[model samples]
Target: MKIFRLTFFLVLISQLALAQTKRNIDHQSLTWIRYYNILPLTEKWALHSEIDNRNFIDPICQNVFVLRVQGRYRANKNIDLGGGFAYFNANTQNPNNNPDYSVPEYRLQQDVTLINDIAKITFHNRFQVEERFIQKANATELLDDYSYAWRFRYRLQATFTLWEKEKQSLKGSISDEVMFNLGKDNTKNTFDQNRIYGALRYAFNPNIHLELGYLKSFQRRASGIDFYDRDIVRFTVYHKINRKTKA
Candidate 1:
């Protein structure tokens, strides 16, 4: 767990340094509820889908709803390749002081994932590239135009078994994900965000599981001078066709 400790420390340092450098910041609390599914059609091909809903709490305001679908190819025992499309209906708290209306975004993404196990501890490395088409918006609200952007993201996650019982087990996981925006449009906030998280997972069986997690999200705004520091509570459900042993 040295890697987790070191990475967590470095991330804390970065957050502190950012607080010192940026004066304009917004604090928000959020909740995310998600459902994820994976099904295998053949020995090598699989389908993955997700439904995610995000909301701002305290006053309980709408934030975003996300839908994703992907087709995966099992490249080898340790690797997988996937490509997918996603849709986002999102609202912002910028100009209106509250979320007035929702806007739309379409995204295409490609991903590569690697998995390894050491003494029952599992490590996951995921790399992704996304092409985003976001609906344009003014200070007041969304406009009719759309803009294009691209970004790359990487996540490192580790999971370990905590306890076991008959047909049930508990697992703990920690993960860190970083995103960087690319292209000429990024003048102010090229550094998108960083998410550091941990979760407790309970498996009823091999194909069904549940998780409750929390994360600190540090996101740079398009204004370049401002940032958003958010605390997010996440709950997720997993339904799989024996995701690990199916093949």
Candidate 2:
């Protein structure tokens, strides 16, 4: 009986060890180039247009391309409401990697931004929601269906004036954003990703500025056990038209 019990315990231990899963993590480096334009239509309304291209570092491959358009309404001095439509072209090494097909994603986004000013520093709090539709593929990696996912994102950004002139300024910015997924199928990895970013912004005039930034991103893959840690270099151009000086 002692020998039999010993055998049983060893078998159970081996079975238990095989049940545990290992985590997979990939590290990547990338770059993003972006353009953003803001056009004011009236005293309290504006339009936003943006485009971005993201690429990989070592072999120089495109990871993703983005186009976004948003409409904003200024509710008051401290509040704004915005809604937008975005299209994303996903490549081989996107945030969610699929080596099979270059998929297309359509997204709808809505957000509210709160602004506060203290001395020469400005703080922006943004809460955003997204409805995402990602094109799906079949067993052989052929386009077969579309999947729906919902996500919520929150971002806190601060901008500070380092030096100022009448028409131009030098500024610094820092922001952190966290994203979460929601749905019945996403139970294991509801926590999607987080990004930490910082930048130096130089304004040539009231209507034009350039920003150079860096970002670190941590993301959980669809399997829930795999992760991607990425470092990114970012360059952006900010443009404005039709200023609302009095309003």
Candidate 3:
């Protein structure tokens, strides 16, 4: 009985220690919502828009908004290629920085899909270039400095239908990405970051879906401060518009 009591006490203490450790690391909570739509302008051409709003409660990033516009060419049933421009606005209201930052970016992406009797797989690849401009200064500088960089990201996902009549499906996905700096002497601001995510998705209907997943991200700074970690749970939702059903 004495040994059992000691073991129980040790377990309780370990749990408390873990909880304290997690509290020490800075935690950021984020909520995001996006709207995507495709408009058919002609026989072979389409216009697309993506608007996203994200809020961060962490010390690093407070609030951010992203917007993008793209033109797509549907070459066939299994492939799509698009080019777009994006703008990002960041609000640095926290005590970490003296000025806020905003950036304008450009991107090109391609998508492909393969469907079979058992399952379906999709791939999306994006290449982006960005120029960052500083804003809301606390100092006496008349103009802000600008920097340019590029990034590449790829995502692969597969889905298997469990009940074809009910549209119930199981899905999994993985993503990999890297960023690089360009057009200057070497600086610590120019580093690379990578991320990988795996998720399971459920389809409520042909037009809407939901996902729950885990993500692992890493950042390698030129100043030798490299950090990597994993996220416990992430949620995602997707919605598509069908013109045939609308009419």
Candidate 4:
């Protein structure tokens, strides 16, 4: 417990220091909601789907929204493979000066989980990789938006139970994710952004869980010269379902 709290403070202090070195810092509050589910289709196959919505707090604007679906194959108890398609739309505060973007993205992803127990405390370490294709725009005689850029993402997360009673449990977690651009047009900013989140998770049962957390996102602007710093309030719900076999 002491170590976790100390690490949390260290992360916050680093973020603040980084904020001071950016070209421009925009402090925006975000309200984010997400729903995730996994439904078993067979012994080794499952369906995964998620919906995410984010709102800007200052002027009550819709900042971003996403809907995604994936077909997953459980390789083993510790690993999973998935391929999915996602629809993403993001609105900029100053559209006239910034790019208005919408992308139909496809991704191949992998998930790995590791668990360790020590001194009556259990820890979960989750690692994930994602390959992304984001659509691009054309300004020539043809107005096609099918041109795409590739990006790769990696995330690492750690969670530990803080308390438990009967069917309910409380947990704390911290995660960091980094994104890299893989194309020349998008390569000016080889490093896209970094996201850091600290959250409290509550498990209602074996199949249902909820998380409420604070997220700090540092993003490089499209011009590749400035940055945007966002403070977010995130809430997410998760559910899992198993397939029933006929006897």
- The candidate maximizing lDDT is 1
Higher-TM-score candidate of 1 and 3: 1
Q: lDDT for each of the candidates?
A: 0.86, 0.84, 0.51, 0.70
Question: TM-score rank, highest first?
Answer: 1, 2, 4, 3
List where candidate 2 sits over 4 angstroms from the true fold: 1-22, 94-100, 138-140, 243-247
- List the candidate numbers ranked by lDDT, top first: 1, 2, 4, 3
> What's the C-alpha lDDT at position 233 in model 3?
48
Weakest lDDT window of 10 consecutive positions for candidate 1: 92-101
- The estimated TM-scores of all candidates read 0.87, 0.85, 0.60, 0.75
| lDDT for predicted candidate 1 compared with the true structure | 0.86
lDDT of 3 by residue, 1-247 (tens): 2432443454456445444542222233454556666666665677778777655434435355777777877676555666666676655323255353443333433433232233354544444444433332334432454444444333333444334456656666665544545434325424344456677777787767777766565444434333323233456566655554221
Candidate No. with top TM-score: 1
Q: Which stretches of candidate 1 lie above 4 Å from their native place?
A: 1-20, 94-96, 241-247
Q: Compose the digit string of candidate 2's lDDT tens values, residues 1-247.
A: 2433443454455335434757677899999999999998888888999999999886678899999999999999999999999999888664444466677999999999988898877988888999999888653574767888899887878999999999989999998877878876667667777788999999999899999999999887778888788999999999998555546
Higher-ranked by lDDT: 2 or 3: 2
Pairs in steric clash, model 1:
none
Distance (Å) between predicted and true CA of 107, model 3?
6.8
* 10 residues in a row with least lDDT, candidate 4: 138-147
Cα lDDT, model 4, residue 65: 82
**Candidate 2: Cα lDDT at 110:** 99
Clashing pairs in 3: none
**Winner by lDDT between candidate 3 and candidate 1:** 1
